[model samples]
Target: MKNLLTILLLTFCVSVSAQTTRKYSNEFMNIGVDAAALGMSNAVTAFSHDVNSGYWNPAGLVHIEDKQLALMHSSYFANIANYDYAAFAMPIDNNSAIGISLIRFAVDDILNTTQLIDDDGNINYDRISLFSTADYGVTFSYARKLPFEGLNYGINAKVIRRVIGDFANSWGFGLDAAIQFETRNEWKFGIMARDITTTFNSWAIDEEEFATVQDAVEGQNQELPETTELTIPKLQFGIAKKFIYRYDFSILTEVDLNIRFEENNDLISTSIASITPSFGFEVGYIDMIYLRGGVGNFQNELQLDNSEKVSFQPSIGIGFKYNCIQVDYAFTDIGDQSVALYSNVFSLKIDFSCFR
Candidate 1:
C-alpha cells in the first residue's frame, strides 16, 4: 500500500508539471470554511455576517458587532487528511471591521519508498521513511460601510504556503475584493471576486531528494518540475432573502452562481467560462436553533458506458446559538459528488461580549 500510494503521488505531480496551465492549482483553499457555510453549500456569500465572513464575503465583516473568534475542523478521506481553520474579527470603528484567518490541509505519515531499493540493487526495509504534504493559507481582511445605506465593501490579502516534506515547498500571494448590499425590504446581494490579481506560486524543489525517484519509473521525472503555478480569478454572485412568519420564526433562502473562467464539467460550461449554481435554505426558531440544507457542485460526468449524467452534492446541518456562543455541525462531501462517504464538520463562534 505504501509503494502504491507513493507511485500515485509521483504520477500526479508529473502530470501537473506536464501541463502549462493547471485548472486546479492551489485547490485546497477553495474548500469552504465554517460548518454553517459548508452546510449551506457556500450559499451564504450574501449574508455571512460575522467572523466567518472573513472567508466567505469579507464585505460582511462590517456587520460585526464586537470582537469575535471562530474555529473549525474536519477530516477527509477517512482521516487520511485533516483540514482546520481559525479566525478572529473585531469592529475597528462604528462602521469598519478587520479580521484575520488561517487555514491548513495536510496528509501526514506517508511512507517514502524511493530509498527502499538501495545501491547494488538490494531491497532494504531499513531505508524506508515517512513524510507529509501540507498546504496553508493566511488572509488579512478589512471592510467598511459605504456612505450609501446598506452598502459595504471589503478586500483581502492572502498568503499561501505549501510543503511536501523536504522535497519541495512554495510561497504564493493573492488578493480578493467583495461587496454586499441590502435593501430596506431585507433582500441582500453580494459579489465576491477571488484571486483578482491572479495568484502566483513559486516553488523550490530539492534536486537531491527528487533525484531518488527519477529512475523509479520509466519515461517519467526526466526533467525538473515547473516552478511556477498560477491561479486565475473566480467570481461568485449571491442573492438572498429572509421571510419572517412571526417574531420568533424565520426562513432564509439563498442562491449563488459560481463562475470560473475555464471550460470544465460544470453544469453550465462554455469555452469562455463555466457556471455552477447552488441553492440553500435555513430555518430558525427564536434565533436560537437552526436547521440548514443545500445542494451544489452540479456536474455532468461521463460514465464508463460513454454516457453523461448529472450529479450534485447535498449537505445538511444544525446549529445552536445562546447568548454570545454558537456551535454548528455539518455533514458534507469533500469530493464533487464522487465520494461515497461524507465528512463531518464542526465549528464554533464566540462573541467577546460573553466575558463582559
Candidate 2:
C-alpha cells in the first residue's frame, strides 16, 4: 500500500508538470486562514476586521484599532497533511493599516519508492526513503480608508513557493485587490479579486532525481515536464449586517458569492463563469462569547446510481474573547462535503496594546 501510494503521488506530480495553466493551481492558499472565518464557511469577506483580514479581504484591515497578531493551525486527510497560518497588522494611521501573513500546507514523511527495487531486481525495503511536499505563501497587504466615509481599499503582493521533496520546486507571484464599504445603518459590502494580475509559477525539476522514477515507471516520464504554470483570477463579493439585541447580545449575518471564470460543477455554472454562494452567521453574548455557523461550497456530485445531486459543506465554531486576547475553534469539512471525516481548526489573536 505504501509503495502504491508513492507511485500514485509521483504520477500526479508528473501530470501536473505537463500542464502550463491549470485550474486550482496553488489551491492550498484558498483553504483560508482564521478559524473564525472557516467556521463561517469563509463568508467573512465583509465582516473581517483584524489581522486575519489580510487574507479574507485586506480592505477590512482599515478597521483594526491596534497592533494585532493572529495564528491558526489545522490538519486534514486524517492528519496526513498539516496547515498553518500567521499574520500581523497595525494601524499606519487613523485611516490606514498594513499587514503581513504567512501560510504553509505540507504532507510529510511520504515514502520515496523509486529505488525500492534495486538494480539486481531484488525487492529491498532498505532502499526506500522518505520525503515531503510543501506549499508556502507570503502576503504583504495595505489598506487605506477613502476620503469618502466608510469606504476603504486594499491591495496585496503575494509570493508563493512549492516543493516536492528534492525532485521539483517552483516560485510564484501574484497580486490582489479589494474594497470595502459600510453604510450608516451598519450594512457592509466587500469585494476581493485574487490573482488579479494572473499569478505565474516557474518550476525547476531535478532531472537526475526524476530519472529513477522514469526507470521505475517504464516507458513513462521520458521527457522533462512543463516549466510554467499560471493561475487565473477569481472574485469574492460579500454583504453583511449586524443586529444588536437588547444591550449585550448581537447577531451578524453574511452572504457571499465566489466566482470562478471557468465551467465547473459549482452551484451556478455557465459557459463563462461559475458561482458558489455561501451563507454564514455569528451570535455573540456580551461581546465576549460567540457561536458561528455556515454552509458553502455547493457542488453537483454524481452519485453511484449516476444521479446528479447538490451537496454542500457545513461548519460550526465557538469563540471567546477577554481583554486583548481571543481564541476560536471550528469544525469544518475540508474535502468538499464528500469526506466523512472533518477537520478541527483553532486560532488565536492578540492585541499588542495589551503589553503596553
Candidate 3:
C-alpha cells in the first residue's frame, strides 16, 4: 500500500508538471508567512532552516534535529486582511523528517449590499447584509537526506479551499518538490518547484441563489464561462554563502530567481518582465541577536522608467534567541503605501527537545 501511494503521487505530480497551459488562481499562495523570510525579502530558499521551511523548502526540514513548532500572524493591506500560519516539524530519524502546516487568509465582515428595486422608487439600504471571504490551505510535507551528507530532497502535498461569503467556493490539490545542497563550507544551493503538478481550483456556484454572481463579473467586462483555474508551474533557484567575521559574528547573504512557465507566451521576455528577483542578507551577533534586511518585487520598477516609480518594496527584521525559544519580528511594505497598509509579521518558535 505504501508503494502504491508513492507511485500514485509521483504519477500525478509528473502529469501536472508536464502541463503547459497557464492559469492564475488562488494568488494567496504567493504571500510570505514566515517573518524571517519576509524580513529578508523572501530570499531564504537556500538557507531556510526553521519550522516554516515546511512551506518554503521542505528539504530544509531535515536540518531540524529536534521537534519544533512555529506560529506566525500578520495583517496585510493595511489591516484589511488577516493572515495566520503555523507549522510543526518532527524528525523521524537521522535521515528523515515530516511536517504539517496550515495557513488561513481572510477578509471579514464585508457589507453585502445590492442594487435592487424597492416598492418605492427610493434605494433600500436597510437590508444590507454582511459576509466574509477566506482562503485556507493544509499541507503535509516529508523530507529525506540523500546518501551524500549535504544533499536532501523533499515533497509537499497540499489541499486548498476558498470561500466567498457562503455563495461560492473552490477546492484544489497540488504538489511541490524541492532539493537542497549544502557544501562542506558555508555555501548552499536550492531549487523549489511550486505547483509542480499545476494546481487546479474547481469553483462551484449556486445558480439559483447567486445567479447574479456571474452577471456581476460580466458587468466588469469579464467572461465567466470557466469554473476551473489552473496554476502554472513556478521554479525558484537560490544560492547563499555565510561569512564568519569574528568569533561571535557572522553574515549570510542569499539571492533567489523566480521563473514561471506559460503555455503560449514568450518564455524569455515574459520571464524577464514578470520575474521578481530577491536579495537579502542577515547579520548575526553572538548567535543570539540577528538583524536582517532585503529588497524584492522590483519587476515593476525595473521595467518602467526610473522617474515613474518612487518607492520600492523593502523589508527589515530582528530576531532574538534564548535556549529553545526564539522570537522574530518583521516590518515590510507590500508596495508603496501610507501608514494604513503597513505589513508586519511576528513569529514564535519553540523546540521540544529542550524540555526532553
When 2 and 3 are scored with lDDT, the better candidate is 2
lDDT of 3 by residue, 1-356 (tens): 23433432332223223123445566688787778788998998999876888888999999999999999999987688999999999999989899999999998996554333244646677755677778899999999999988999999998999877656677999999999999998689999999988887777755433543333223322233345668877888999998989689989999998776643222133633335578999999988999999986653222244443323468999999898998999998755532336788999999998998
Please, what are the lDDT tens digits per residue for candidate 2 over residues 1-356?
44574575465565356354578788898998898898899999998888998999999999888899999999998899999999999999998999999999999998888888777888989988999889999999999999999999999999999988878899999999999999999999999999998899888888888776666775555577687888989999999999999999999999999999889999999989999999999999998999999999999988899999999999999999998999999999846575657899999999988898
> Where does candidate 3 have its weakest 10-residue lDDT segment?
11-20
In model 1, which regions exceed 4 Å deviation? 1-20, 121-124, 217-221, 334-337
Write the residue-wise lDDT of candidate 1 on 205-295 in tens digits. Answer: 8888777666564455556778888888999999999999879999999999999999999999999999999999999999999999999
Q: What's the ranking of the predictions by lDDT, best on top?
A: 2, 1, 3
Question: What's the ranking of the predictions by TM-score, best on top?
Answer: 2, 1, 3
Relative to the true structure, how large is the alpha-carbon lDDT of every model? 0.89, 0.90, 0.77
Q: Which is the winner by TM-score between candidate 1 and candidate 3?
A: 1
